[model samples]
Structures are given as C-alpha cells and as structure tokens.
Target: MTRSVETTSSEDSELSLPAPKERRRLREAAELTHDEIAAAVGVTAATVRSWESGRTAPRGRKRELYTQFLARLAARRQDGGPAGPPGEAKTARAAEEPAADPPVPDPPTGDTPTPDPPASDRPTPDTPASDRPTPDTPASDAPSPDARTEPEQLPAEPPARVPVPGPAEAFDALYALAARDLARQAYLLTGRGALALEAVEKAFVQAWDRWPEVATDPDPVGWVRAIAYEYALSPWHRFRRAHRQLDKPPAEPADRILLDALLALAPANRRTVLLYDGVGLDLPDTAAETEATTPTAGHRLVHAHADLADRIPELADVPLEKQSALLRDLFTALRPAVDLEPRPAAVVRGGGERRTRLWTRATLSLTAMIAVSTSYTLMTAPTHYEPPPAPGESVSGVPPLAGPQQLTERGKQLHDKLRADPEAGPARIAPRIE
Candidate 1:
C-alpha cells in the first residue's frame, strides 16, 4: 500500500544526527520549548525529551519529521541569525560584542627579533614622546601600540548567560514537557481520551498545589507521571458517568489490537508493563514506582507479556524490550491533534489553588461546628443523675368509653314519649327530674 511505502521511505531516510547532547544543545541554544518541537514532529513532548536524553529514538514518520526539524534548527544557527530564538535581546547583545575592540594580540617573535622601526616610519600621534621607542630601543622592550602586528584577537565569548525561568515559568515549562506525554499515557490506561486528558490535568493541578515539593523531587517528570497514571487507572473512574463509555479504538487494526490487549490486563499487570516497557523504565525503578517488590513486579510483567502475546500473536515473536516500543506507539493514535491539547498551565494552577481553598474553608467550618456542639453539651449536661419521677397508679371505675355521659334509660323513654306527643314537648320538659 502507499502508506507502507511512505512509512518505509521515511524510516529509510533517517538523518545523520549528532550526539543526543547536541540535539538538546541546539534546542536550548534556540530557546525553543519542547512542546513546540513535539507538536511539529507529531509526537508528545515527553517523546522529544526522551530523544534528547538518548533513551529512545524516533522511527517511521516521526524520524523523518524530527530530523527535518533539527536540521532547520541547526541551519538557523549557521545562518548568522541571533544565537537565541528570534526576537530575543541576546542577539542584540551578541552583536554589540563583536563591534567592541578585540583583545590586542602579542607581537610576533623569531630567533632574531625583528627590530622596531624608528618613530618616523610609523606616525605615533597618540603615543607620548617618552613612550615612543627609537631605533636604538631593543626588541625585548614593550612594543609601541602601533607596532603590535598580530591579527585582531577574536572577541572573548561572553559568559554564557542562561536566563533562569521563574517558578511559574519553571512549572509551565515542566507542564509543557510532560503534559502531552502524560495525557497519552493516561489514554493508554483508560480507553477514554477525555478522561485521559482530565487525569493529566488533574495531576498537574496537584503538582502545582505542591509545587515546592514536586519541583524539589529528584524525578519531577516521573512524579507527575505517577500521579497521572494513578488517576487514569483509578477504579473510582469507572463509577463516573462520563467514563462509563469507552472511546473509539484507533482506526488502524494493528493499533486497535495492541490497545485491546492492554485494556484486557488487570490494572496492576497493566501498570507494571507500562512502566517497565512503555516508559522505558528499568526493572527496579518500575517496581519502586508501582509500589511492588521486585519479584512481584517481575511476575506481573511476565503475566502481562503472556497475556499480550496471546492476544496479539505477532508480539509473541518480538523481544520483550521492543514490545514496549510498540506499546508507546499506541498512545499517539488514541486521539487526534485537536483533542490532545491539555488545559493551559495558568488555568490548571489557578483551578488547583481554588480547589485547595474550598477544601480549607469546608474543613474550618466543620471544625467550628464540632467545637460549638461540644461546648453547648458541656454546659447543658447534668453533672449527676437526679431522682426518677414516680410511676402512675392504675385507674379503675371510669367507663372504657371516653365522651359526654349517656342519658339514663328512663330519661330516654320520656324523651321518646315527648317526641311521639309532638306539640306536648314543652310540658314534657325534663323539669320532672328537678
């Protein structure tokens, strides 16, 4: 197919790259951000970082694109443009340095020292009469300023003044580097693209809240990655309405199979495989990150490999390490470019601060309520028990029915007779009772 040929051509056209260090140096020299490079190359910023770290290299379309970008970056330096990225003041300062008078070179020497010419041969208008050397002066004496013949000394390179990014800038830079990769990794763990991005953003938000601690951590990227992974793989996410549905699988059959195999894994085995393979972590590190003992981590990895082999027959033939690379490839196919954009660093940080404040307020209110209730109870509660109230005696003689008293049988009869006598009612009044 045309696609196969294109991929082959791209892979075959790998550029003769410099040392991995050179790649990083070039980018830094240009003051380019990792996100910019990653975006242009159709890969995640983490992938770009790994490339510069020499832990991994791009292949296929990625290789061709990355090579082209690096080449351009190098060319930009060669073109005599500003050493820093365009529009930086560093270029202007660098320009001014070359214009400054270069350091004067020492006079050339030979076995027979060349004689200094008399003051008549070279006009020493600026030289003082006493300082000017005559023909009688020995060559060993300090040469007059005009007699200094060495080529103009090149300007000393200004101490490489690298601008240190501020805390907010540093956090944003880290976010730019790790956010995309974390999002992709999260997508690999959870089938939903939206949830994956959400998890990544949430991880950054948490990191921002604890910026001091996170920034000081030895492996800030790994710290963020671990948090993202935890959020993505959390069982509680399954309970969320939004995450209940799975995202569509990658359109390519190969990528879809890889994803399906990964999803079939139990979360532990899945996480172990991902950390060990997908992220290119060593065995010990994978175990430590997963919070498992080495032996347990190894077993999980074995099981994961077996499951993947069974589900993806082709992988059975590949070596364990290469399988990890293939796993990484699946992340890029999970979503398109538009969906991959994570929330901005500023927005994420602000949200985190707000969330922390809300929790703090809620906690203080709850504590206040508990304290008030305790004080009120202490004040109102009796110090000792009082004597009990007496029990009521049983009542006898009262009618069971509760209502106005019933008329006697005689009175009822007389009432009935009066009713029968009609107009005689007045005479038949109850006065008889009196």
Candidate 2:
C-alpha cells in the first residue's frame, strides 16, 4: 500500500519523460546496431541504447547524422520495393513466386475460323500450298546437321555466361568523367603521368563498384579525386620502398609550357593547388579534402604559382593572375590526352565528343582536296609513280604524345620556387634534389 502511494505521488510530478516516439521512428527506419550509430555520432553504445530507449536524448550533429542515416536507409528500402527488410519472409515469398509479366493467351482451337491475311496477302481457295514455304521454314532456311534431324549431343562444356549490360549503361560515362578528372588532378599532384593514370583508374574502378551511391553524390568526381589522393598518400605508398620523390624530369612540349609550371611544386602544395586548379574545387573544399586550412590552401596555390615562375622563366612572362587561367586550360586539354588509354566498353559514352568520327570526316575532306590536285597534276604531266616499300620494323603510329611533359616541367618550376622562397628555406629545403 505504501509503495503504490509513493508511485502515484511520483507520477503526478513527472518532468522528464522518455522519447518513445523518436526511438520508434529511428528503429523503423533502419537496422542499425547501437555501436555503429554511437561510433558515427561520437557517443558510447550505452548512450545510444539509452537514447533509443527514450531514457536520454542526443543533440546537434549527432542527431543530424542519425537522421541522415535513417533517410539513407529509407531510400535503400524504397529502391528495393515494398518487401519487408532484406532476407525477411516477405522477401523470400516474392522470390519464390513467378513474376506477373509477359501475359500468355489461351491457345486457339483448330475448329475456330482463322482470320485471313490483309488485302496484300488475301489467299483464296484457288491458291496452292506449294506457292509458299510452310510456317516452320523460309525459302532460305535449312536444318543443319545439329538441328532437328537428330537429338544433338551436348557440347564438351557449356559456354560461360557473360553478363548482359542493361539499357541503363551510363554508369561507364559517369565513371570515365570521374577517372578523367582524377587522372588530371593526380598528374598535377604527383608530376608522374603514369602514377596519375594508375591512381585515377583505381579510384574509378572502385567508384564503378559503388555506382549507386556515386550517382546520387552532387560532386562524384570530387569525391573520387579526394579518395584517389588519399590512396596515393596511404601508408603503403608513403612508408614503403617506393617512397622516393619523382626523380626524373617530365618530357617537354612547347604548347604545354603553362602546365609545366604548376606541376613543379612540393607534393603537399601540389595537391592543394591542383585540387583547386585542376578539379575546380573551391578553397574550403580543397582544404577539407586535403586536411589543410583555407589560408594554407591559398598560400599553397600562391607558392605553387611562384615556384612555377621560378622554374619556368617563360612563365614569369605570363602575369601571375593569368597563370591560373593558363593552368586551367592546360589541365582541360590534358584530360582528353590521358583518356586515350584503352577502357572497357562500359566506360565509353556514345554521346560525348567523338574524336574518331571527327577525325575521319576531317581526313576525308583533306583527301578529297588532295585527290583533286593530283588529278589536275596528272593531266598536265604523265608521271611515272614508284611506291616505297613498307618498312620491316613495326612502328606504333605516333607513339601517343608521351604523357604531357609540359605538366611536369611546370611542376619543376614550382619546386624551384619552393627552393628559392626565403620562407620555405627552412629545414624542408635540401640542396640534393630527390
């Protein structure tokens, strides 16, 4: 009687109540473990449990993350249709049932009158069966040895099932965009063309595997570019035997003078500058991705430009403000250059700039002009023609303009600036070039 009286008195003055409605909302949205939610929100699992149970409440970003988590979960469920959660009885039931599609009609009885063909094919009683081939065969059709003449023996092995791509094959185009962007950025970052290509390819392959999430991201390429940079800077890359700085100078091209300037800075500054310059990420985004300050990113870009001027004296002629613009154009052109690398069918889009098609048309136009000139020349003088013999050795047609040497040259320019800058002249500078 005393315990009941105390419980009733406490209930009358209730101030703190458990948030059961909020907990139920979260629970219905996803099958998140308490630990996972807590870890994401920087809280303990016990705290998460208390919150979920309405014994406590989370606030700020923690709450926001939870809400996002639920939203993402809901999106995934909606995509998969109204089956209960995956692996549940409802899902299993749907899997077991045949899909209601490709409707089949009842077979017609032989006694039913058949409809005649249209006016063009109106065959009367006077028409003969011999005038046309039977329904089972066309005029050119024939039963091969492996056909219905006999029960054919099975092959030694069944052919492997190749995956059929769906009509929605634009994933490859999206992937190529990400790869091209990452490759250009990586090239600017490492000043090593091959490494940049490899890094971008790896990142793109990973992105392709998670195309669904990537498709929804506003800046998929930006996400990939950041991930690629991180991959290049990972422990295996940084602390391993391959940790030496790029030793050789990049090949040179006259037109690539401006790009050759930007690729000249130290790796850190290279990344910061390139993230802003190459990928078109804003200063804050660059800093966030690179784990640097906005001011630091700005400084890095300034230092990068200065270094570019130092190494490539010609770059000094270009105004500092114009250097950024020049670098942007250089990278824009280089994107297509690296994209020349062979990629899977899924990775090429039909609608983008068709270089081959354009080239073919241009070639044909030039050939027509040459043909007209040759015809007139032949009429003026009877010329004896002797064709040169083909060379014995095979040559790869104009060995793909060896990875933009100009970008690397620009990189060296920045490196030189770092060496000369009084502020960067600290212990970081070494006389012995790596």
Candidate 3:
C-alpha cells in the first residue's frame, strides 16, 4: 500500500509552526532529548528549555533550523521509519502475524491463473507494519507513526534534579552576586542606608527588565553600579537629608570625625576624594565618571586632601603615600552593612517597564507644555516704548559734537543748579517746556 505525505514549506515551518506544545510533541515522538535538539539547532539546552517552557521562542536562523529539524522527523515517521526503540516492538509483532491467505480462488480461473490481479492493485506483504492498524484497536489508542506524541503525565512528586539556568535564572544570579556590594557602595556615597538601598534596588530592577541586553554587556555590574550611583545623587532624594542626619549610626570617634569632615567638603571635592583615594580609581576614570575634566578632578582631589588635613591636623602628619591607604581604610569602615537577597524575578521585571513608560509620557507632556507657555509669553509680552528724542539731540548712531571737557563742564553747571534749587526738576529747568 502506498502512503501520501504532506510537505510543509520552509516559510510556513518557520513562521506558522506551533510553539512549545508542538515542539515538545515532535521532540518526544522522535525520542530526542533537549540537548540533542539544542545541538541540532545550535543553541544551548537551556535555550531549548526556554522554548519548551514558553519563556522565549526561537527566531531568525534558529527558528528556521528548528522548523527544518521537526519537518525531517515528521517525514521519517510518515515513511514507516521507526521513531525509536519502542517502534521496533510493533514492527516485530506485525512481522510475526501470518500473511493474509494467498489468492486461493485464482486457481479456479483456469490455466493462466488470471495473471494474478495486477501487482499494483494488490497490497504488498512487505509493506511496513506502521501503515496497518489492527481492527481490535482504535487508531487513537494505538500510536500511529505519523501522529504527534503527547507528553507523558509526570508523577505528582517529580524527582529532584538540577535545573539549567535560563535568562531569568542568570539575571537572578547576577543580582544576588552584586546587590550587597552595590548597596554598600551607594551607602558610602549617600551616607544613608535607606537611600542607598532604594537606589540599588531601583537600578537592579531596571537591570532585570533589560536582562537580555545586560547579560551580554561586558560589565553588567559596572553598568548597574553607575546607575545606582547616579540614583543616589538625584535631587529628589535631597529632602531625606534631615531624616538621614537624625538616623545616622554612631561610629568610632575617629571615624565619626573623619566622616563629618568628608561630608563637610564640597560635593565635587568629596566625590573626587571617594572615587580616587577611597575607591582607587585612576584620575582619568574618576573624572569621566564624575563628568569633570582631568585637571578639575586633580584640583578637587588636592583641595579635598588639604581640607581634610586642615580639619583633622593628624592627617597632615601622615605621609602622602599612606594618606590614600588611610582614606581607603576609613571609607571601607564607613560603608553600611547590607543584608541582601535576590528579589522576586517577577516583581523586579514588572515595575520597570511601567515606570519607564510613565516617565516618558510625563517628560513629553512637560516639554510640550513648556514650549507652548514660552511661545505664548514671547508672543504676548508688552513691547517697550522709547520717548521721541529731544528736538536738538542726535540719535544714538551720531557722535556727540561737544568735546569730553565741554560735556563735563556742562554737567557740573547742571549739578550746581540742581543743588542750589532742591526741588529743581528736568521739566521746570528745560528751556523747551510746553
């Protein structure tokens, strides 16, 4: 018996193929593991899990390859090929069954034996077993070579195994690894644990939302650190300064004095000292991060050191080489202790997009409103009027006829007349008064 197979176009396979369930079915039917499929598609097994779990879908070249792989498996099944070892049992059973009784009635047809019903019209005994279904069994009950396989029902309590980390897992790992250090850094910069925590949390949430991009970055932690630093410095947090001062934790007397002295310095000087002396960043790098010129950064650092020395006379005695080391140790001691744990992935990912969209809308609205207000003000503002020039006086462009000495003498005479008559006014004194 001949079987007809339907073929799918590459475009259809790539663009219109069913997702996780269909992919899962094809994989199970072919007795292939996720790793095997991943290797065939040139992706990680974790990526394959992501596809099967609906976390992500294959796209571009990967999608094309996955589609083609599934199509080949489907074709193999359609052509009576064994899906795997399980198929071999069915083949053996079909082979053991006796062939249908040969054409016995043909013998009565006389000498020529009626040239045995043309071979094309008769079913071939050699036809593969998969094409034939037993009458006692329903087609659905018996697994068909062409039918897609369904995932087997797993036990209520599945066995424990290590799970591969997908994008979400990787992001959580990164956050867990970096959050505490980032928070501590922010705390050192802002001098308030709560504000520092808030900044670090916000930056991490943003990182989580854009994990695919962040995961591929050369220094994802540094990117998040920069964001956290900027967040701590935002003007919106200034109102919290009084509260922070009230809630400041007590420190060793020396450390306390040092911190107070550091805080007293100008913000630029303080930041330069912290980034260069405390954090051990090079001058150029510190300057770039702080948005200052190298020369300006050097000036700030030098002034900061001088100011600190002036505040604590003991610092003046410390050698130049050891001063940076001392400051680094002092800053390290000042960093607030941070107890950090990985935040819920969903929560971290959810709020960032909403916040971004709201911020964008608000900014656009504010800009448009400001533009309109400015245009209206410029258009409606009253124009200044200048009185017509005195009849004998020249306009601004003409040079004065009188020499400087003559003008000076005339001015003196006018001043003397005004002094002699306390109430003398320009209108009364002028010869051309109407």
Q: Rate the local accuracy (lDDT) of all candidates.
A: 0.75, 0.58, 0.68
lDDT of 1 at 125: 82
Q: Rank the candidates by lDDT, best first.
A: 1, 3, 2
lDDT of 3 by residue, 1-434 (tens): 21111223323544566678877766776667888887787666777887887865564346667777778766656665555554332332243467795553432323654355455545568876666444577545855423434566777997789888898778768777778777766665666767777788799887876777888875676678778888877767667655345236434566556667876887678777877766555565577778999899989988989899887655777776556656655666553333434355456656676787899999999999999999999998978977887677645877767755645888899878878975567666667545
lDDT of 2 at 97: 68
Q: What is the lDDT of candidate 2?
A: 0.58
Supply the TM-score for candidate 2.
0.36
Query: In candidate 1, what are the lDDT values of residues 1-434, reduced to their tens digit?
Result: 00111223322354366668988887787667798787687656777888899876665445667778888777767766557544452331253365668796676666767676565766568878888667688866956656675677798987988998878999999999989878777877877889989989888988888889998886798899989998888899778898898887766666677788889999999898877666756565677899999799989989998899898766676677556555444444344322667988988988888999999999999999999999999999999999999899989998687786788999899879867886575665556653
Who is ahead in TM-score, 2 or 3?
A: 3
> What is the lDDT for 15 in model 1?
38
Model 2 over residues 1-434: C-alpha lDDT tens digits? 00101123223222222255645444444545677666665556666676666644443234455556555554555665753542352322243467686564554467986576467555567789766446778434744323644675886988899997653465666664556555656665655556666676566666655667877775666667767887665546645444445524434453244455554557788777666655545455667778888788788888887887676554567777456544554555443233335355354333222544687899999999999999998899847877989879867866565674555888999989877877664556556566
Please state the error at residue 293 of candidate 2 in Å: 3.0
What is the TM-score of each predicted model, taking all chains together? 0.56, 0.36, 0.41
lDDT of 1 at 389: 94
lDDT of 3: 0.68
lDDT of 3 at 241: 54
